[model samples]
Target: MSWMEDLLLLGIGGIAVSVYGVVAGLLLLGIDRKLVARMQARIGPPIRQPFVDVQKLFTKQNIVPEHAVAWLFNGAPVVALVSSLVILLYLPIGSIPPVLSGYGDLILIMYLLTIPALALVAGGFSSGSPYATVGAQREMVTMISYELPLAIVFIAIAWRMSADGIGDPFSLVTIMQYPLWGLVGPLGLIGGLILLFILLLVTPAELSRIPFDTPEAETELAGGLLVEYSGKNLAMFYTAQGVKTLVMASILIALFLPWNPSGLLGLGGILAAGIDIAFFLLKLVVVVFASVTLVRAMVARFRITQVVGMYWLFLGLMGIIALILLGIDAIGGA
Candidate 1:
């Protein structure tokens, strides 16, 4: 294709992926709510509750606090939503290579993963409320806490692949093509499992879901980072939250469970692609339920100090152990 044709295709694909991210994100959030309610033996909100909630938020007045940096407060939501959606463009969804596969890789995706949280921190600090400021600090702390284990997980996998002679080990396509599970021995399998567990634990914190939601503790902080937001601004944050959930789940799927139904079933053509996409959605729901909904429903919020301790000390040590095991496995294999 010519440069113009490639650009046109890219634009069209980008639009399609954006629309899918928004709709799927909201749908997954609704599903999460409904599932959590059922798990508690109560009638839940409809699966469309998120959509209704966003619509209602949009109808309300978007108030800018008199003490706030209005531009940063307002712009933060856009940044969060856009950055979360951009993650999808770089991730391989089911049988489809990432829309921008060649343009970026897993390293870029890791960096992108932090952008939404940073946006939340920006919004909170810019809001100028004491509660918002505290929340912003907690959000930054949470980001710092989880990043070590998260990076270790990525490095462990990529390093394992590189040891096995794969080029571009950090590439999402390369990682997907040679799943860590297939490349490892018995010890490496155990290490990979540990890394997967660490990543799964990181997911709730990364998305700021409960037990890990210190930044948005409604009871104490009164909505915390979002205390001052309302109307369209709040709506954007809500949508961004959903998108972030989807992005995190997608990342977990791409890393730990990159399997596709079509290949297993010996399917071909559009039908295979359709089945694979459906299967991918199923995987997303499962990951979200396990990492987000179930954890939120089962655990109470942790104190900020405890949150920091758990991630930085416990999870960080566990991630180091996993990486060490992988290193040993690589040496043994060699």
Candidate 2:
């Protein structure tokens, strides 16, 4: 195809992916709420509650605090939502490939992941509320805390793949083609599980969900980073939150659990793809349950100190141990 056709196709694909990301992301968020409530022995709002909440917020009057920097306070939500959607285009959906694939995908995602949180910090600071400021500071600190363990998990996996002569080990396509579980021995298997465990723990902090929700501790900060937000802007942030939850879950599925039962069942062609896609969505449900909903139901919000200690100190150490085991396994196999 010519460059013009490519561009047109790309544009169409981008729009399609964005729509899917928004809808699927919101649905997952609502499902998470329902599951968390059930786990807590309370009847939660309907699965469509997130959709309703977003719609209601869109219709409300958007308020800007008089003391706030009007420009950034307004712009942050737009950036957060758009960037989160951008991430979806780079991810594979079941048997479908990424809309935009390249060698630098993981690196690109690593950078893109930071943008939403940075936007949150900007929005918080721009709002000029003491609560928002504190929340923003906490958000930044939390971001720093999680990066070490997150890096160890991805890098260890990619590095192991490279050692086995896999090309472009950092590529999601490549990783999916050669899952770590298939490549590892007993030692490596244990290490891979530990890394998976680390990643699962990291998920809550990435989403700013419970146990890591100090940034938005409503009980204390009265919504903290979002204290001054309302109406359309707040709706955008809320939707972005859901989209980001999808992003994290998708990444987790891509990394440690990119399996489909189609192969086991001897499926092929469109039917196989369909089955795989359905299975991929099911994996999303299980992963979101394990990483977000289960944690939310079981764990209370961690103080900033606890957040730092948990991610940087505890998880960080475990990540290193896992990486060491993978290295030893590689050596023994060689």
TM-score of each: 0.98, 0.98
Q: Which candidate is the best by lDDT?
A: 1
For model 2, give the 10-residue run with minimal summed lDDT.
99-108
Misplaced by over 4 Å in model 1 are none
Q: Which candidate number maximizes TM-score?
A: 1
Note the residue pairs that clash in candidate 2.
none
> Once model 1 is optimally superposed onto the true structure by TM-score, how far is the C-alpha of residue 86 displaced, in angstroms?
0.9
Local accuracy of candidate 1 as per-residue lDDT tens digits, 12-84: 9899899899999999999999999999999999999999999999999999999999999999999999999
Model 1: colliding residue pairs = none
Q: What is the lDDT of candidate 2?
A: 0.92
lDDT of each: 0.93, 0.92
